[model samples]
Target chain A: MPEKAQILDQLYELIQPFAKEPIEFGEQTDLIDEVGLDSMKIMDMVMQIEDHFDVSIPLNVLTDVRTIGDMAGQLQGLMKDD
Target chain B: MSELLNKFLPLEAKRSELVAIGGADPFHVVVERVVSATEAIVNGQQVIMAGTNNYLGLTFDPESVEASCAAVRDEGTGTTGSRMANGSYGAHLALERALADFYACPAAIVFSTGYIANLGILSTLTGSGDVILMDADCHASIYDGTRLGAAQVVRFRHNDAANLERRLQRLEDKAKRTLVVVEGIYSMLGDRAPLQEIVEVKNRYGASLLIDEAHSLGVLGDHGRGLAEELGVEDQVDFITGTFSKSLGSIGGYCVSRWAELEFMRYAMRPYIFTASSSPSLIASTRIALKKLNSGTVLRKQLWANAHQLYQGLAEMGLELGPQVSPVIAIRLPVSMEEAPGVWGELLSKGIYVNLVLPPATPDGGCLLRCSLSAAHSPEQIDRILAAFSDIKEKIAPEKSG
Candidate 1:
């Protein structure tokens, strides 16, 4: 499984196309309110993460994710489970 | 009977408030005359038909009309019984063969209506033990299909292939038995499914895939088979369902597949066996429409042109739009839920008619002025529709413009 730093790097690259501006990936920064990830944008990122990690992240898992850090941590956990 | 009536008591009480705001049930708008594919007379006003599911605008096609007339003369007006009980005419079998050939699939089953296609297929294919992971924004017919089948239904985020995969992952060992259902073009949003990505996810999970091509058939792809063909994943799709109502300009629904297992559904599916077969006229007209769609290069081009023009026109007006440029263009209402009817009423009063979608029916609890463009709509009609939107927006919610 990849580390949190690796997951965060991939997350930044994944969101670039949908992000209106550069995203400041702070640990506590809300993905929706701070990173400006709307419903569509979040879905796009989820698809990229699924492909990149070869892991199927559940829809309910998203409810637990608030920030980019949470997403990266989630990805790390899912990858380890795989 | 009284207990049955009790269920709708609250909704019945809600009707007066709608009538108070010039909104009469929006569901039952009477059309007095259909002047053209794009023009209809409704309640004494000649309104532009920006709400029809007539994507290819071939409702008045001479060839289609002639075919329908010919079938009626040869085979009589209607089949008086179900397909299993003498309703199955020789033409019905022929239509199924023709549809299978059109999609290059091994088999196809035609249902009485587009809605019934899902009702029969989904209900029959999966059962109580199986799980169905559908897009959250799937058509009501699909939701009904799963319920009828007695399957555990789980909804993924709309158009999110990842969300779909995630839901399947939760199934674990049962993932192989799961069915992933999506639509080619969502009716409300007008956006397409990411077929390639979905196929990948399906393959990764060893799950099955079904796509409802209700809105995209004859509107997308070089072959006009639907979004599956457009994305070059036609072979990857396990089941492809579509309607004759939209682009075919007729009535009926079909599910085509490479697997011959679809033939088994004929005997097993209640919706297929018990339902009265499509009339000879509908089958003949649809056959011709399918053939026309196969060679409808110019027609598809015209449809895309019309869709692009309408989408760009609304976008230029600074109106909120769906994700993509499709035959369906939805303009958001920037007002309260109660104020939506006033805006819809004003649009209708101005000789422009669109599908007025309210919260609960609309996704994200939004209201929309759904404009479904047809190939038959003239360029002038599109311009007029745009002006109506601009005028209505400026009048209803002028503060948004500032």
Candidate 2:
């Protein structure tokens, strides 16, 4: 798997518990709609992401994230910044 | 801008209407009104108050009133600071000591509100990498606290120990750090948690336990110590968190544990460190209330009697009730949002007040008229409430029958 695909798979694994249905890892998968992530569940996912990647994602970033690709891109950006 | 605000508006507008109707205060003492509490006084009407949470009826007690007055006179209006700053005073320490003795625990930390107690304790104790196994029906405060802690929170079925066991079994070997949370008595459904089974599950999983005794503190146990003591697992549980707002007739919360290190969390918990400490008057009144709780077996008996009377009354009316009888008697209404408003309005017209709960607040897509009984309620008052319900049934019965 490519590096981005590997990262996306890890993110999907972290979000699986909170998702009401199976989540597909790709650029177009809407994080909130497909996974049924409410505000609380979204925060839970963010915390897990922070711990797993060892990076702090500000809560404000959640408002801009709509899809798995958005989240992965944000994570990648945070990793680069670190 | 207005349109943008509309987009964020609640979709359940009809349910809000029903709540508003139920809460409208009648201008007359005899009429049932939700918001106009003083209206009942003006009308000279015999209103049966079922909406209030004054379970022990201590709020009406002369002794409590006097104690509150004295505390206000002695301690002034507020503490005006956080416990981490200027919040802790002599009265706060005294109350903490009293709660420690009452629970027979080595350490007790008080919070400004019952909500904060859960928030402070849960958020501070658990963190990233820790797990929180909670009941699905746990209070919103507990859920928010777990969120604030940023822990991996998993919920089991409401009051189901076996499901909790199954969830715990799936946790990593590092599950020893997991925190299991449960409530002593659920607020919405008026049902008690299976503490014994939950404790057994926790022990088997090697997880720590935190039980929020907000509803059960003065309503359960021999000395009103709460579910932990009532179930004979007081020593087994790691922490007991409760509030003075419910049965104690005051405003504050506390968590007690045998672990001395629990006290250090007080310093780190943001809710405790940021919020202003509870007022001196509240602490004084709560301390007195605790003493009254310890000595007043008669009050508890009377409360139970009233609860049973109301439960049986509602049950005989063929109203759907909770699983087990408690001080809270929730009458499940037919699941029609349109019909609920009419019934709630009729109840208020009959001079009886009750809490109107609609989805998604109620479980299983039902509406609830939650009636809370108090120890101070006279047998006559309970009968009066039943009579109002009967009258309501008569008015609504024809609609259903037709």
Candidate 3:
């Protein structure tokens, strides 16, 4: 399994295209409040991350995920289970 | 302002801005009088209805009206209690049996409204540690049901069987504990679930499948049993839930299942046990309406004919529509959101009333002028509706219409 840092890098890459406006990409950047990704765009980005990591991230885990770093941790945990 | 009321400031501001646009308020349309199943006096003007989901238009069926009247006279008006208390009247049990027989299922339960049916069933069926795999485009009631329950909720891409398979595959042994939920015909777009493929995936993963046929009942299949019957997969679908408000022309909801365990849900569902049961008049009319819908071949034919006519007319006008021809046809506005209220207001002024759908409520955050056809609507009514849309086509798609 890839490290959480590597997963965070991949998630940032996957989420960049969904940003409606250009902004600094970082681990602590709030996806909804700062990056301005709407709910629909967030779902799309989640699908892309799911495909990239070949992991199924249950929505139950998404309630606590707000930043890119939180998503990376979730994805890394899902990958370790495999 | 109180903390409870402060949160509504943003929504209230949006409504105020929409009202300032100098058009009819889409949220506060007042129907002064009902002219018929197809026409209503809205805002003091008689309009052709294209938004009401009265697919079979049985609301004014002479026999049903008489039956409801007789029920009101004989059984009085309301049940006055929940089914768990003193409310399971003979009529309620009879309706449940009739619904079970109509769907050819062994067990059935009834709720006060369609929304309650989803809430009661979904919350009672699964518990903590269980997962609900639902289509992302499912109705609000389905979403609310998942939230009300303790189960883990996961949404698959809408109508994508491969995505569903991937989620189920990841669940592995937990797949058996998962409940997959989808709708027969999506309310907004009027698109249907790929039930055959979805059923296959569910069976492969040992998951149960529940189909909400709220929009498809009396609109699909030879016998109008909905998408499962239309796709010849009724046996594969474990639970079928639908509303009486739409096709039945009454107000109630039902869920029919072959599982003997569903009888337990009647006792366990808090939504059912706490809420008052459907009134006797509604139940009586629904009984007759279900019988009519069961054999509503002629009405279904006319309904489809009207759907085709309106769809073809809108498409010819260069206005966008849902993916296919359905009784529920939504015209996606190719213009800005600010322009939609005016367009909808203009349609209403032309004696045409359709639903004006905005973002978040819409699947894609786009504006929509949604129309649902009724069997009661005549060919001329369809023509008038088309003409009304044609009169304002340029506002919807100026470049395309030009």
Candidate 4:
């Protein structure tokens, strides 16, 4: 798997376009509200991330993910299978 | 606890907010009276309609209207039973034959609605151990059909042939078992699939291809066949599905194919068998509309002309538009979601009735004020629509060029 920091950065970049204001990604940062990502935007971002990382992140995986930290952890689990 | 109700609370809240912002109920903006193919009275105000997908504008055609009325009076209103039982009227078979002749395919099957055509065909054509290679942005019916078929569904990027090839390459026995599906013109974006490119990829991989010409029919090709015919890949496409609702100005769906084996779908397709067949009036009127769609060169030219006119007019207002220009001209909102419906409501109050598409339906998360143009729309009506936009230009639409 790629480095955690690197994955986090990619995740940040994925959502940066949808952000309402200048935002930063940290462990506890809410991916939805803080990043201003709607459910559809998140779905689009997840697909892009899956394409980039060569991993299949299912909808159920995202159901449990709320914060940037949760996303990183989920990505780690999915990429380990690869 | 009622688990279903609990599960739907979030959706309930979202819909409530959407309805609240639109002032009136957004879902049912009832057309109080339809004055013509392009004009309707909504909430007691006469409005120029840009929402109805009457692309060829045959709904109010005197011939179609007369024939349909006659059928309704003579034959009856409905089949009242599923086609599998006693519902296969003579008119249904006739429409199917006409569709097959129009597509120049060996066989065609007509369904009650376009939704059922996808549901029936996609399910019956595949099963367990087969795989469906679908576009990520495919219509919901396509996805549901795959689910019902119990096939492994893998989504490629929308309209990206390379992405499709990549998925097909990864599959074992890559070609023989995989079914790749795309839309001739995607309903949401009004963008077309690179059917020639998709066909090339499918052929190279030996995979079968299905193109849903739901939006492109009567709007794209020289003969109004669809995007596949427009791109000169009609013969190569394994299956072509389309709706009679939009261009035909009637309610029904059809799938045509060169393969004679497709006729066996009458026995195997559940959605087709279990559902009531289309009424005689719909079939009769649809037959009339199909002839016009096939032979009306002037109508096709006028549709494109109107499309380009509205597309350019919206672009001049600095509004974001769907890629290229077709009958469906989708204007996206660059503002917040809250403001999206407000703009839609405002447009309605100004004697304009267009679609207010929100999240999940739109390709991106953005909202859209989608307009479906028709050939019958007069130049004066087009001007009125443009002027309505001019009336509320800066307040709602973003100042983003192109």
Q: Pick by lDDT: which candidate is best?
A: 3
Worst 10 residues of 2 chain B by lDDT: B34-43
Candidate 1: how many backbone clashes?
Answer: 0
- Give the TM-score (vs. native) of candidate 3: 0.96
For model 4, how does the per-residue alpha-carbon lDDT over B1-402 read when each residue is reduced to its tens digit?
687679879877877787787565567678889899999899999999998988888998888988899999988998898888986778888888999999899999999999999999888897777778888889989977876786666778888888778767667483578889999888877888988889998898888999999998998888899998898888899899889899999899999998989998789888988888898899999999998888768888888889889989988888778997888888888877767777888888888899988877888778888999999988888888999888888875665458
TM-scores for all candidates: the values are 0.82, 0.79, 0.96, 0.87
**Model 3: per-residue lDDT, tens digit, B1-402?**
688898889887887788678467898888899999999999888999888999999999999999999999999988888878985889899999999999889999989999999999888788998989999899999988888889988888899999999999989999999999999999999999999999999999999999999999999999999999999999999999999999999999999998967998887899999999999899999999999988759999999999999999989988878997999999998766777788899999999999999987898888998999999999999999988888887778636433
Off by over 4 Å in 4: A1-42, A55-82, B1-12, B22-24, B399-402
Which model is ahead, 2 or 3, in terms of DockQ? 3
Q: Which stretches of candidate 1 lie over 4 Å from their true place?
A: A1-82, B1-3, B23-25, B395-402
Of all true interface contacts, what fraction is found in model 4?
A: 0.05
TM-score of chain B of each: 0.96, 0.90, 0.98, 0.96
Q: By the DockQ metric, which is better: model 3 or model 4?
A: 3
**Which ranges in model 2 have alpha carbons more than 4 Å from their true place?**
A1-82, B1-46, B394-402
lDDT of each: 0.84, 0.78, 0.90, 0.84
Q: On residues B231-272, what C-alpha lDDT tens digit does candidate 1 reach at each position?
A: 999888899998999999999999999898889888889998
Q: What is the DockQ of each candidate?
A: 0.07, 0.07, 0.63, 0.19
Which structure among the candidates has the greatest DockQ? 3
> How well does candidate 2 score on lDDT at residue B74?
83
Score chain A of each prediction against the true chain A by TM-score and list the results. Answer: 0.85, 0.88, 0.93, 0.86
Please give, as one word, the docking class of candidate 4: incorrect
